[model samples]
Target chain A: MKLYEYLAKEEFRKFGIPVPPGRVAASPEDAAAAAREVGRPVAIKSQVLAGGRGKAGGIRFADTPEAAEAEARALLGTELHGHAIDRLLVEEKLRIDRELYLGVTVDGAARTPLVITSVRGGVNIEEVPEKELVKRHVDPTWGLQPYACRQVVRRLGLGGPVGRQVADILGRLYQVFRSRDAELAEINPLVVSGDRVIAADARLNVDDEAAYRHKDLPRVEEGTELERRVREIGLSYVELDGDIAVMANGAGITMATLDIIQAYGGRPANFLDAGGGASVEPMAQAVEVLVSTRPKAILINIFGGITRCDDVANALVQVRQRVGIPMPLVVRLVGTNEAQGVEILRREGITAYRSMDEAAARVVELAKGAA
Target chain B: MAILVDEKTRVVVQGITGHQGAFHARQMLDYGTRVVAGVTPGKGGEEVHGVPVYETVEEAVEKHGANASAIFVPAPFARDAAFEAIDAGLRVVVIITEHIPVHDAMQVMAFGRSRGATIVGPNTFGVISPGKSKLGIMPNPIYRPGPVGIVARSGTLSYEIAANLSGAGLGQSTVVGMGGDRVVGLGFVDVLKQLERDEETRAVVLVGEIGGTAEEEAAEFIKGMTKPVVAYLAGKSAPPGKRMGHAGAIIERGRGTFESKVKALTAGGARVAGFPWEVPDLVREALGQAAG
Candidate 1:
């Protein structure tokens, strides 16, 4: 889960990391008030989960409170990269002698936490030359030792007092990264002043699976209202840009379903997992959620192991009776209780295929016909 | 002749009193797996499906002589449960729990490796040796004893492929679900290595997805093996950066792609199947060539 800049900075402050003081503003009036509180030139950064906000004109610098208010007024309620700018971070602007990048993240391949620092900063790290970036893997058992920080600092060609300060910041950042169960904790541009280094921006991606440990973190509001509503019903739903709504039981099967759909020349409208071991109620809710997308057709694929195909079939029949599906529905049910599942679907005047290939082809044809 | 667990391998269940643990425990026992003991912290004096339960894995190992453990502990406590089993001197630990934190998985994996223990998964269906012994959540009726060894990441996909293979007169020696998480303990390489050494497994089927370099790494290892391998990789048409349910099933920064995986495996002399259903024919053809 990605946190807003203000929230991430708040976490950074709690860890004793130096960050430009900031307040979150939800409206133009609040933006002016926050700018007045800071009593200096401020940067009004639009708060949205998506990236490239600056290039999209979601960020602006204001020399005065009125300017800040105007900038906020222009961005508020506007959509950037399909995400609304509902809030803004008003932070004190600082004079920077140089911009340096530093962060800590889990290297998925190595299965180790990595500390990354670079002399080239204030730009996308991917665009920077590989030679300019200094990276070191921190052993999960031993953690980020002081020597590890010094190595990153010295490689970037920093020395004396400023290098020590940056090294200290790097150490503390690693602490926050580990303790918070963060997938990524980065300060894109750690501005270097005369003798001080401060974080100009914070980008934190917390591990959603580790959310149980931290109750203090705010809940991430994702996707559209319909998508959110479906999530509230306890189904994992992701909206996509297509015309066929695809639903499956397991993660691997769901992806395979999506792949086969696209392979047969059909686009998927959404990715919905009924979850492993889901019964009639959750399965019914899943169908209801899939209908909310209003796709031209629906593909319900279940390779039941612990999850029973009969349960899924029963739920589909229930939804067909109560809600009355308007779109063409294609289903493939296999594994445990599959015979009963197929019989139930057939009795309901719905065609259920035992082969995923047949179901996928039928759905794609239906989708194209509907289109 | 199976790679890991067989009829002689005494199995212990960790978190045996839990819903999933108890359910799968009964399934394993019914399938003729020698489930000698179960471990649940405070349910020491209890029994799950007539198998004796112990507080610690050490006690289970000491009292029952169990060499393999199938872990059904919840995600939060899965690491500790695995650690206990490893520290207790179990050689093979099969973890069926999902959503274990990556850091915890890393620690347990490192600890397991150091002790020469093979940790299967942090999010898997466990391992199954058809008709002889089963140590996973797979539906038992779908399997039969044959010369093919299967190693896969996705649980349901593997089941689908296994059933298809069974229908085509090809059964499995053992099928291992390597889990679908980003950071899993054992990879395709480790399991493939085991299958290569097993005399019962004449040919191998690798079910992979577009994630991590596990498939690529397996391809590198396959170059050294004499056994024929047939591969089927999922998520061919999946969009980049969109996680297709599995955490590891995504294409990012130009790596872990379906094309790359297929290229690597094909270059390593494995016949890569276009779809899961095609695997059976590929396996048959690969085996026939060897016999010829």
Candidate 2:
């Protein structure tokens, strides 16, 4: 789950990592009040969960409280690259002598925590030259040692008081990364103003699987209206900009169905997994959620192992009875109690296919016809 | 012989009293797996599906001679359960629990490697050696005793591909799900090394997705192996940075793209199939090339 910049800065503060004073403003008046409170030139940044915000003009600098309010008013209710700007972080802008990059992320290649440091900082870290970036893998058993922090600092060509200070911050950052179950904790543009260094930007991504451990964290930012609704019904859902909605029982099957649908020239509107051992209520709710998207067609692919196909068919029957089938649905059900499940669907005048390729092709044809 | 488990392999289940643990445990027993003991703290002496229950993995191993353990513990307690199995000197440990914290997963992996144990997954569907032994949650009817060795990062995709192979009169020697999490216990390369050494596995079928460099790493390793390998990669049309159901199934920073994975696997002398139905034909062609 991605935390808003203001929240990430607050979390960094709790770990003794220095961050400039900031406040989240929900309105233009709040932004003005915050700017006046800071009594300095402030940066007003849109609190969206996507990247490239600077390029999209979601970030603006204001020297006065009036200017801050004007910028906030201009950005508020505006869409910056599709994400609506509802919140902004107003913070004191620092006078940077130099900027450095520091990040800790889980490395899939090493299967361990990797700490990355570089002299290249600010926006577009991805565009930074690889030769400038220094990476070190922390031993999973021993964790980040004090010496390792100093080594990274040295490799980044730091020395004297600033080097020691940044090393201390790096150690604390590792602590927050591990203790908070963060998938990524990054501070791009670790600015040096006079003798003090502050994290100019905070980016944190906590693991969704470990979210239960962080009870104090606010509700995670949800994506799309359909995603939020399906989440409430306790099903995994992700909305995509396409023409067909794909549903399956397991994560693996859901993805394969999506691949097949796209391979057959059908664009998937969303990815939905009913999850293991789903009952009639959740199954019916899943269909209802998919139908709410108003896609051209819906593809239901079930290769039931622990999930009985008859139960899924029963849920489809319930949904058909209530909401009525507004869109073309191509269902492919197999495995446990499949014959009975097909019988149930057949009685309702719904023909279920046995081949995934056949079902995906049929859905593509239906989606094309609807288009 | 099978890659990991066979008829002689005795098994123990952790968290046997929980809902998922109990349900899958019964299924494993019905698949002809030698389930010798079950472990659920404070529920010792209770019998689950006619298997003796113990308080700890050590007791289960010492008393019943269980060489392998399948964990069904919840996410919060998954780390301890995995450590217990490793500390008890079990030869193989399969963690079927999903959503284990990354830090805990790293620790479990480090400890297991230090002890020279094979840890299957923290979110996997487990492993199966068709006809002889089944230690995972895969449907038995889909698999048959044959020469194909299957290793996948997906559970249901493996089942679908295996069933398709069986439908085409081909069978499997062993199938392993390496888990779909970012920080998993094993990878395609690890499973591939074992399959290369197994006499029963004449060829390998790798099921991969867009996320992670495991498939790329496996591609590099396949260059040195004598056996032929065929691959099928999912999420070809998935957008970048979107998590496709699985946490590890996202393409980040242009690293784990479908194009890159297919390119790497194809360069490694493996025939990459575009669809699940096409895997059997590729496998058959590769096997024929090996024979000729």
Candidate 3:
């Protein structure tokens, strides 16, 4: 649910937050044409969903249309840090005296939305000194106050008309962030050129849950190969890499399976939430998808409520009988007709653990012992 | 003896005519929960499974003396329903719906907290005292009341923890699912505080996942507690750079990672059960230490 820089900038404009003239181009020729139209000295940035693109040569500065074309040609098809760059955004580079960082995101600790502003910009916020980051949370109930915005501007040492402009933009961004159900709305390297303030880079990630309400958004990542494979088997599959693959019922247990793998000093290869109502057919497919990794070990953690452990156990048995996956498994079954599941798994020489702590610890030991 | 809800707790169901609401309400009543009223907007004057329905939570609370409400409305209307419950003077509310808009949840949660109401979830299975009362959709068949106070963000994870404890001849005092959404009314620390004060709870079995600072907050709370806690965090290292499942279980660049929560819990002197199966034993060990 991450918007490209161009789309994010469009949102910035909606809030009256200024962004330099820019257009996204699908090709080097298009980028070159855009540079000619925007008139020279453009920044050709790779339109990838990740950051640190500049360090990876996915971003380049070009002073002429020809140079912009050259940079776009070099970057448009090249894979930067594992993501293949298919487009480039040619932006008129803002000449700034100073850069500042401003952003708003949901605070996990306070379970509240926070507005963060700082003089520190043009670098990863994580890299900045924690003490220097002037951060304040906006109680969504209470809209961002001019006083609070001014305090941030004053503390960050931003002065003149630019400071008030930044405050206005921040308020608007927060409004947009809230209205759009965005997980984060960030304007990095917010630049000051004379009296003009422009957003050098815009990043907006819409919350996936909230995306259901945003009907205008194009369905991004349409049934990717991994997603398609899961859908074919009617399984919930999220790809990751490690030797251990997890198959669990419900989001909580799937997460717990992952946590257990980590706690046992193991890395989980995937998180497949078979969900609360999954049956044997879906469970078998889920196991098939999980085993497709050919993991070193597979952990099936089921805290069945609507989903019975027996059905999960039966599904695992069917998977073993039919597909014969590569990994050995550890089973932790609990709740909602668990006895039948235990009976099935035990018949297959699998013993269900009594507790998640025990199951997780054992899998760690088993995976280690196997290693 | 229970932490949140029991037979004495008066309950109302928002969205009572809906499938999830009607279904779980029956189950809660089966578990001995005193569900007195139901709210389904236009469905007032009707009864959902013998529970009288009203048009508003205010009417339901006024009519039934309902002070606690469980919501089954969809994510979009969950915010309004929660506010209505709070407005009706329900002191404790449980929102089982998931994927609520963060802004909506923020307003509802913040407003509810300000009103001195404890909101259990916006994406959780709700809470249960097990054998005494169940406020959520947790299948009533598997649970039995005992001494373990369970608090987890994931529904099935809590049931698994309870099942394991039950298998080891231990029953739960109460198990609370704080919800898996990014923003929830309750937290691990909030549940832990109640568990800490509940005398029937002799020991606590805590289940946590990666992402968010909730586990870290709970770890900090645990450092101040005198009760025995057997803690298990979901999402270990999880491949060096994986997005932890559930919106809240994120690694986020380099903060609130699973490793950090585990480290914080271990540093705070809570028994870190390496996985699900080891939790009962870890609890037994911690309880033994407390007794010693």
Could you say which candidate leads in TM-score?
2
Q: Put the candidates in lDDT order, highest first.
A: 2, 1, 3
> Which CAPRI category fits model 3?
medium
Q: Across residues A307-328, which tens digit of lDDT does each residue of candidate 2 receive?
A: 7899999999999999987999
lDDT of 1 by residue, A184-206 (tens): 99998999987889999898888
Best by DockQ: 2
lDDT of 1 by residue, B1-292 (tens): 9988888999999989999999999999999999999999989999888888999999988888999999998888998999999999998999989888877877787788779998888788889999889888888888889999999998888888899999999999999998888778788888998999999999999999996788898899999999999998888877777666777787977779999999999999899887778989999998999899
Poorest stretch of ten by lDDT in candidate 1 chain A: A221-230
Report chain A TM-scores, every model. Answer: 0.95, 0.95, 0.86
Off by over 4 Å in 3: A222-224, A227-236, A258-268, A279-285, A291-299, A310-334, A339-371
Every model's DockQ: 0.64, 0.72, 0.60
Q: How far is candidate 1 from the true structure (C-alpha RMSD, Å)?
A: 1.8
Chain A only: give the TM-score of model 2.
0.95
Off by over 4 Å in 2: none
Sort order, DockQ high to low: 2, 1, 3
Model 3 lDDT at residue B113: 75
TM-score of chain B of each: 0.98, 0.99, 0.97
